[model samples]
Target: MRASVSTVQDLGMPAIYLHLLAELLNTIGVDERALLLRVGLDPARLKSTDLRVSQAQASEFVTRAIIESGEPGLGIMLARELKLPLHGALGTAVMSSRSLDEALELMTRYLTLRAPHLEVSRREEGDNVLFNVSCSMDLGPLQGFIMDAMLFGCVSMGTQLTGSPVPGAAILRRGPEPGYFHRFRQHIQVPVRYESREDALLIPRANLKLPVRFSDAQLSASSRAKCEEALKQLTEDAGFACRVRRVIETSHPFPPKLARVAATLFVSERTLKRRLQEENASFQNLVDHVRLERAGELLKNTGMNLSQIADVLGYADAANFTRAFKRWTGTSPSHYRSQALQPIKPQASSMRATA
Candidate 1:
């Protein structure tokens, strides 16, 4: 099944899914026990108020489950029943925004209200918008879940604004797994990038000025103060781009031109190019390298069809993706995956497993 969320409530931050998973698993009777055993996790860990499964532990656990089930879509399936709260003054502010842009700003400001470790911000990227996130905490078992929920949030907000999910979303994520890319793009119409600098959701610049029904000047005045007042007391200082990283860090196929991205940073693309050149990189090269890195991961793991893989990497079609993959590595996806499956290098960051 393509990525689909039926629940009306917003899927809260990543940990929300963990909590939901724990509860669901418990309700299912021994589901938690079974899920935990695959990762060598103790069942009691799920009982904690906020479970802290280390990255290593989570990687091992999810990897084992994927292999045993031979079902690459498990994480997304687990994600469907999650509910994100639309409560709070921030939620009210979001509901009250006059445009998707305003709603985005509301989300950017209020995201930290619930998840202190994650932050989101946006800036004009010329004819585009650049939403960004920066984070200090390791989400561990909740990483994918949290990231997926963020994507859902953005889509839902945009859909709410236009009364339908827009087909223009382009996602970027740095994770190498094909599963995430496929999982992401299967539902969202735009391209999904894997193994990119960060996760980002992009909409056209045209959507910036859209009029929202709830943007009444008086009501906005009333709600604006409430949001700002709450923001003032926020004890955490983690600012901007944590939520953005959730998408682009996995796949970065839908990259606009570096100059375009540079424009979003309020810098000339030429100047941006010059600065990146100073750093021994160019925007296109960075985007390509990220895509290649993600392609490598997708080829190595997951059983997704090659056409599906191509779609996720932002190719016009399978042939284009194949040619690019061969160009990048001088071999086919099949050959690459065959090579990648050998000995599966163990690493702290690489989420790996065998089926």
Candidate 2:
């Protein structure tokens, strides 16, 4: 089955994914809230079901979580926790869907709402249907984790939706098996093959007709409508500018050069500039946007000195950084830091009554 995907690459990822990761970390004695704060993510923001964290922040936080927890298999662990309801509208739609195939169709169409970096395609090989999962961007070291979560998450989804594992279903991976996977192998219900050409889920063709345990026609209709609107809005908002911003957000050496960014995106400098101009944006503006965002994160979250912060943000010296920060926010960096870091106060009326 071939489905058209209407989405932008790396636009943003649902906050629920990260929020769930935090919860999983907490179970293992990691201070999830402090970890989120250290990554410049406000702990309160993840509470919103509709909220999305930028790809850069998400990448950084996940990387840090894996490193700090020393759990390279965190992806599979997290997959184990992905209950249907936790997936928002997509989950609802899948739950209410008529059969396994119908739910997969919805996922193929609306996957961008959850993980914008991935796309799914379906193919038939003998008696099995392969759901090929591919990354649309260069995810760096994070690719393995993302792939694990996605492929295994599908296995989890099948078991939840069908009330049991789909008959004769298996998983395919592109690389050799990791040592850590041996620890989790006993718990996994489905067979997983490694060193394949791609990451995919293989299920018997007969399994597609397995009816969902809790199918509801009216609920499925409503949820699919919601998914459509979300897809439309996400596609409209994700333009060349958004892609450029993503590149800027994840680049190393603080701010990246234009040529480097263009090359990373597989475009020439002139084409990159022209595309941004079409979207009423410029390369420098996108860079500045990411720089200012990181600057604020560093100022509020870390105690780095002005010189250190300057160098981190690609400025020649503290003086230049101070000038740029003032220009961006109309306040000196020191003053802004004081204001941002200050504790909130109670209302004057409440204070007076207490007094």
Candidate 3:
């Protein structure tokens, strides 16, 4: 999908991951320059892990890569190459953790710095620990690829930390099994079950206590502090509108009320409104913007009908959603989804040249 103006200004991905994708594409005989151009990304500006690109740009690039390379297992391939250092501070924190359990805890806490669209939670199921994965946004066609990379990347990184295979760790994918499922077994070296009820990792509790190969107490403390500080800076750098937009986009009930959003942000409603005004935005505008983007995503990527989409977006009915969607894009959801089946021409104007 072509990114809307608000989407270009709001959602983003870490540049490091983009760089890794570029490297992989380059190795596979894809022209990195041409690929970046297709997504309106600038290679020169992506030199640092501190930089970021719009989520629209990242998702579009992956979509194009899959089409161009004819590789449905691209995410799994990329996950195989993911080393701990590539994750920045979160990587360091994981590497320095006292044990695998602590490392997983740090990953749960700081994963958003790398992937803002995912939510990670840990629960105890008898003697096993379940690390559940949930998405905050509809990932469109990129859902399977992204999830594969993330879940497999977790396994790869865990192995790197403990310096051996993570015994009894198995993957549970909610979607249908891919034809190239062996790629997962090759990299993760563990049992994987697709068509499960949830996307999670079933980790044996005994393995959680395994000592990290690079366990450094002092470095772990320092790295965690750095991660916290960096997270604060990252939020501040996103500016007021983008920050509020993220909060709204990730809310569980879709478009949460202004007061609820304010509470989540730890500010009074009056203060939240005032800050938004300072940024030349309003809560309603951000809410509508998020709803419109999410509506477009679900329409394009999922089989959920208009009524289901309406319920997900907090609309009274499909009729109301249809009206709002037409107001946003001058087309009905059905027409939009039909058009989305066709390949979209890459637009240079869809992304900023520099973040």
Output the number of the lDDT-best candidate: 2
lDDT scores in order: 0.53, 0.82, 0.78
Q: How accurate is candidate 1 locally (lDDT)?
A: 0.53
Q: Using Cα atoms with residue i matched to residue i, what is each candidate's TM-score against the true structure?
A: 0.45, 0.68, 0.66
Model 2 scores a TM of: 0.68
Candidate 2, which ten residues in sequence have the lowest lDDT sum? 346-355
Query: What residue pairs are clashing in model 3?
Result: none
Candidate 3 at 276: error in angstroms? 11
lDDT for position 78 in model 2? 92
Q: What's the lDDT for residue 258 in model 1?
A: 47
lDDT of 1 by residue, 36-64 (tens): 55444444333333223333334445555
Lowest-sum lDDT 10-residue window in model 3: 346-355
TM-score winner among the candidates?
A: 2
Residue range 5-82, candidate 3, lDDT tens digits = 334334367777877888898888888778776555556446466666656557778888988878888899899889
Give residue 326's lDDT in candidate 3 (0 to 100): 76
